[model samples]
Target: MTTILVTGGTGTLGRHVVERLRQDGGNEVRVLSRSSRPYAVDLRKGGAELDAAVAGVDTIVHCASSPGGGDEQAARNLVAAARRAGVRHLVYISIVGVDRVPLGYYQAKLAVERQIEESGLGWTVLRATQFHDLLVRLFQAMAKLPVMLVPAGVSDQPVDASEVAARLAELALAAPAGRVEDLGGPEVRPLDDLARSYLRATARRRPLIRVPLAGKAYRGFRSGGHLAPEHRVGKGTFDDDLAARFS
Candidate 1:
């Protein structure tokens, strides 16, 4: 059986990946988190504990990420520790348009991708569109205000986290393939419309205003750089996610 370690296995996407892997049965799965026992190791810190967490692990699915920053440093630490442990494969989940989008988080993800590719280890990187949970969180924060202000001309293809998790599990079980095809949601829709839909679903009425922001990152989003129309492999829709969440 392949011994696999999953970083941030308690997180939104990581938990799904762990569940699918466990449900498949046969592999020895381990989760590395600050709160997990024995294997608990913070990816952002390179130390003996992190090294121990990677020992004897054949593959690692790196799902731990921080939008507040420090992801690049975390990747560096993980790569070094994995190398020391003689890990055979490293699987990573990244966001689509990480290279195209100028956001700091995207840039950090892209940097991590580069580190993985050049680490001399067999690696598989899967870049997917934004997840439905992310969108929901965004809308939830926006709804807190009396008036919802959204970015103008911005569209998103929000994929299901479960589907993405299944894909990641499959990849972890297969031979390493460097940089597979991008995965996207079933459809792309404007952010404003989605916000309105969120309001309707939550039974909250709020005035929506679209404000155009001037910036490279905003422009990247407005131009749909994050979209993968050709690889709309995800079958779940935003409405479906809303129904499951709000209902």
Candidate 2:
């Protein structure tokens, strides 16, 4: 049986990945996290805990990340530990448009991708679009204001986190395929439309204001730099997700 370690196993995407891996059977799965849950190991600190997690693991699905900050250091530490343990494969989960988008978080993800590439270990990097639940949460936060401000000309192909997790599990079991095809949602929808849908689903009425943003990040999104139209591999749509959650 192949031994696999999954960092951020408690997270949204990581949780799904772990669930799928366990369902597949015939594999020993370990979860790396700060909590004292079963098979949990702290990966932020590259000491004995990290080493113990990496040691004897045939493959590592690296889903642990801090998009706001500290992602690069976390990846670096993990890569170092993997190398020390002589890991056979290291799979990393990254966001779509990390290279094209000008956001600081995207920049951090891109930096980690580069670190993994340079690590000289067998690796695969899968770049997926924003999760449907994340977009819902974004709209929920925006709904707090009297007037919901939506970024004009911005579009997203929000994929299901569970679908991404299944794909990651498939890649982890297979041989390392460096930088595979990008994974995207079933449809590309405007952010404003998504917000309107959310408001309608929740039966909340609010004045929607479309504000044209002026920044490199906004321009990138407006220009469809974050979209992968040809890679619409996901079967779930935002509307379907909303209907399941709210209907």
Candidate 3:
């Protein structure tokens, strides 16, 4: 059993990956958590603490993200830490169109990828589609009002997080495959339809109103529309994701 280190094992996707590694496959997995007895160390501090924990690990599943922390600093620290430990493979979970789209979260992921590539280490960056829960959460926040206001004229193919995590684990097991194909939902649907579906699922009687936004992020989403409608290899659909919203 190859021993691997998974950052952010306590997070939504990180926890799933850890379970899959232990349950689905016969692999030794260690999570870099902040808690005692389990968490090896913190990567935010250049991974000195994690170095001892990951001394002999074969791979590093870098799921630990700086959601509120700036991406540039976090990515630099992680890459440096991995290099210091001589980790063989680094599997990073990122969103689709991160390079093309100029968003805070996506840009952070892009910076992380660049750091990994520049580190001269084995790496595989899996860019996933938007999680179905994200849209659900968005509607949850917006559906309260009589009008479910959403950005208009945008196409999205939200993929299941489980599928993405499975793929990330598989990629972690394999050799480095730089910049893999974009993973997305089976069908592409408008954002408004997705919002409506969420409302119906939750038995909410809210009408959706499309609102146009003027900005770089909106322009990027409208022009290319961070969607993988052309070559989709995902299995879950919008309804399927809605069925298994959260566990």
Candidate 4:
């Protein structure tokens, strides 16, 4: 049986990946998280526990990440341990436009991608557009105000988290293919429109306004650098997720 370890296995995307692998059967799927027992290890400060977790593992699906900070250090720690354990395959899930987007989190993700490529292990990196769940949380926070403000001219192609997890599981079971095609939702919609949809879904009325921001990052967003229009492989849309969530 192929021994696969999923880092951040209890998280949003990681949990689904773990479930899909288990449902497929025949593979020994292990979870490595700070909270998961028997293998609770923090990649940021990896030590004996992390080494133990990577030991004898054939493939590792790295899904652990922190948007606030410290992702680069975590990637470094994981790479070192994986190399020592002689891991054969390393699969990573990243956001679209990590290279073009100037956001700090995007930069950190790009750094992690480089770390994996140079680690001498068989590796695959898949970049996907923003998840619908992320958008929901963002809108939920923004909707607290009397007027919802969004970045002007910024659009997002939000894909379902489950779909992304499905793709990750498929890749983990196969040989390393290097960087694959980008994945995105069926349609690219503006943030204002999506916020309006969220309001409608929640049955709440709020005034929505688009505020133009200044920054290369905001400009990149306006120019659609974070979008993958040609690779619209995702079927579920933001509205689809909102309906399922609110209904």
Q: How many residue pairs clash in each candidate?
A: 0, 0, 0, 0
Sorted on TM-score, best first, the list reads 4, 1, 2, 3
Error of 1 at 20 (Å): 0.4
lDDT of 3: 0.80
Task: State in Å the error of residue 237, model 4.
Answer: 1.2
* Model 4 misplaced regions, further than 4 Å: none
Candidate 1 lDDT over 44-146, as tens digits, reads 8769999888999999999999999999999999999989999999999999999998999999999999999999999999999999999889999999999
| Candidate 4, residue 244: how far the Cα is off, in Å | 0.8
In what order do the candidates fall by lDDT, top score first? 4, 1, 2, 3
- Report lDDT (CA) for all predictions: 0.93, 0.91, 0.80, 0.94
Let me know the TM-score candidate 1 reaches against the reference structure. Answer: 0.98
Tens-digit per-residue lDDT, 1-247, candidate 3: 7888888888778888888888756788988866634565656665557667677788988888766765577567767777777888988888878888887877778878888877888988888888776777777889778888989888788877788888888898889998888788787888888887787677779777899999888988987658878757788888777766632
lDDT of 2 at 66: 73
Candidate 1 wrongly placed segments (more than 4 Å): none
Error of 4 at 46 (Å): 0.4
* lDDT tens digits, residue span 1-247, model 2: 9999999998989989999999999999998877846556656567877887788999999998776688888898999999999999999999889989899999999999999999999999999999998999999999999899999888989999999999999999999999999999999988888898899988899998899989899999999988999999999999889999999
lDDT of 1 at 95: 93
Cα lDDT, model 2, residue 222: 95
In angstroms, the error of model 3 at 51 is 1.6
